[model samples]
Target: QLGRCRSVKEFEKLNRIGEGTYGIVYRARDTLTDETVALKKVRMDNEKDGMPISSLREITLLLQLRHPNIVELKEVVVGNHLESIFLVMGYCEQDLASLLENMQTPFSEAQVKCIILQVLKGLQYLHENYVIHRDLKVSNLLMTDKGCVKIADFGLARTYGMPPKPMTPKVVTLWYRAPELLLGMTTQTTSIDMWAMGCILAELQPHKPLLPGTSEIHQIDLIVQLLGTPNENIWPGFSKLPLVSQYTLRKQPY
Candidate 1:
C-alpha cells in the first residue's frame, strides 16, 4: 500500500495545527489538486519497531470508515525517509477545544444540540461498524467553517466482536473517563464512549470541562460527590471489579 501512496512532498504544509499523543497535525495544501487538507505526521521517533501498532490500526480503520460526521482519511503519504509517514485527512477549520477556549460566550442550546447530534450520528455509525472510539473528548472533535462537525483522532479506537475481549482501562483522558474505567473494568464496551458523550454534552453548555479530576482517586471522588456513592443495589457487580477493594467507599447515600 505504501508503494501506491503519493509522496508527502506533493502537499505543501501551510501551518502546524495541533499535536496529540500519536502525531502532529498540519494544515496543508495538496499541490496535485490544489485542495486544502490536514497532514498528520505519524510519530515514530522512539519506536525501534517498523511502524507503531496504533498508527497501523488507525490507517486500517480510517480506510474502511466513511461517514459525513467522521473525519475523512484521504490517503497515506510517505515522506523523503521511509519512517516519515503522514496521513492525509480532510481539513477542518477548528477543533472544539480551541473554539471553546477562544469563544467569549458559551454555545447556544440549539448549537450544542446540533453538535451533539452530529457526534452521536458519527458514534452510532462507528458502533454499528463494531468500532469503539476509546478516546472521545472535545479536542478530538473538529468543525468546518460551514458548521459541520467531524470526529477525529482514532489512535485509541478498537473494533470489538461477540464475546468481547479485555482491553486496558487506562485509555481515555482522565476528565472524560467513565466510572467503570476508573474502577478498573477490563471489558470495555460502547458504554465508555457514551459516558464521555455525557461529559462533552455537559461541557458544551458551560464552556468548561464537566469533571476536571486531577487524578484517578480524585476523579472517583468527584463522581461520588456529584452522583453519590454506588452500592450493590445501584450497581450489581460493583464489588466484583478488580480494583474495587483498593479504595474505601464514602458512605454518602445515593
Candidate 2:
C-alpha cells in the first residue's frame, strides 16, 4: 500500500532537474541501492484530501506500461509531510527540449530520424494500448547519456476509444497543438499526437519550435502559413467546427 509507502528519506536529492505540470522533478541518488533516479515531487499542496487527477492518471498509466522508449516509474514515496509525495523514476541525462535549446548545432537529419523513430515506437505502443498522449513535444522526450530516447510526462495522457470520444482541447503545449484542437474540436484521437510528432520533426530540423504562436488564433495562422488554409474541399467538415467561425483566417500558402 502506498499509504505505508517508504519515506523519501531513502533517496538523497542531488539537484533540481525540471518542472512539469503536476510536479517538480529532481535528480536524486537512491541511498539504499546507490543508483541515480529522477524523483518527481507530486504537487498536492493545494489539495485538502487526495492526489491530483493528473498525478493519479500518470501513476496508474505508467504502472501498466513497460517499454524501453517509455520512462519508468520505479516507486512512490512520501515526504515528512502528508502532502509531500514523490515518484521515483528512471533518470535521464537530459530532455530533447533542453538539448535543442543548448546545442550549438541542430541535429542532423540522421540523428533526427533516430529520435523520431524512437518517439514513434513509443507512441505506437501507447496507441496500441488505447492511450493518447495528449501532450507530445520535445520537452516531454528524455534522453539518456547513451542517446536512447524515452517518452516522459504522462500527466496529460488518457485512454481513448475507437469511436473517438470528446476530450479537452486545452491539453498539449500550444506550439505543438494540432489544428483540430486549435479549432476547438474536443474529439481526441491518436491523430492529435501525430500532429505533434510532425511539429517535433520540423523543430528537430531547425533546432527550434516550428510554430511559436502568440495566441490560439496566431497558432492557427501559423499552421495556415505552413500548410495553407483548409477548406471543406481539403478538410471535409472544416467549416462546421465549433470555433471555426470565431476568427477570420488569413489567405496564405506555404
Candidate 3:
C-alpha cells in the first residue's frame, strides 16, 4: 500500500475528491514513482477539542487490518509537530458510490454478484477476526483496476467479542442499518453486517440503493413493512430499545 516514502511535500495534488466531516481526501501522485495515491489528511489541530476521536479510531483500526478486501493503511506521516497526520493508502480506481452514480446503464446480475461476493468475503474475514465494520455502505467499497473490492474507512469499525447489550444502532449508515440496530439495541453481531449486505445486494440490480430512507425512524418503518416488526419474544429484549416502547404496532404486535 505504502509505495514510496513520499515527503509530505513530494506528492503532487491532482484534485479534491470530497470534503468529509473529519478530513479532505485528495488524489495525489508520488514524485518519485509517479504512482497515484489517495491522501487522507486529518484536520486535528484546528479543532477546538483536539483530534477527532473518529479519526483516531480510523488510524488505530486500519493500522491493524491487513486483509486484501480491507483497505491498507500504508504509513502515517508525522507532519511538522503532531497536529497534522497524513495517512497513505493505495490508489483505488473508484468507490461503489461513484460507480453506481456514473453508470448510465444498469449493472449486470453477474457483475453485482461478483462485486458483492468480494465484499462478503472481506466482511467474513473481518468478522472471523472479531472485527466489526460499523459502516458497511456501498460508498465504503472501493474497487481496483483489476475489479477487486477493498473495504475502506475503518473509522467506525471496532473489535469486539460479543457486546454486553443487544445490537448497536449507532454503528451503520441509516439506509443499510440493521433492524436490531435500528431498534436501538447495542449488541454487535455479524448479522448487522449481513443486513447491510442485504441492502447492498438489493442495490446491485439497478445500481441504486434498495431501501433509501431519510431517517432512522423511517428506515425502521420500511423494515417493518418488509420483514414485519420484531417482538421482545422473537427479537429478545425488543422493549429494551430506547425508542421501541414509544410506539404501538398495528401489525406483528407482540
The number of the candidate with the highest lDDT is: 1
Provide the RMSD of all predictions against the true structure, rounded to 1 decimal: 0.8, 1.2, 3.3
Ordered from best to worst lDDT, the candidate numbers read 1, 2, 3
Q: What TM value does model 1 have?
A: 0.98
**Ten contiguous residues minimizing lDDT sum, candidate 1:** 245-254
lDDT of 2 at 119: 94
Q: Estimate the TM-score for candidate 2.
A: 0.97
Cα lDDT tens digits for candidate 1, 70-137: 99999999998779999999999999999999999889999999999999999999999999999999
Instruction: Candidate 3: give the clashing pairs.
Output: 166-187, 167-185, 167-186, 167-187
- lDDT for every model? 0.95, 0.93, 0.78
| Regions more than 4 Å wrong, model 2 | none
RMSD of 1: 0.8
Q: TM-score per candidate, in order?
A: 0.98, 0.97, 0.88
Number of backbone-clashing residue pairs for each candidate, in the order shown: 0, 0, 4
lDDT of 3 at 117: 84
Candidate 2 lDDT over 1-254, as tens digits, reads 66888899999999999998789999999999999999999988679778898899999999999999999999989988777889999999999999999999889999999999999999999999999999999999999999999999999999988788888889999999999899999988999999999999999978878999999998999899889989988899899989999989988753
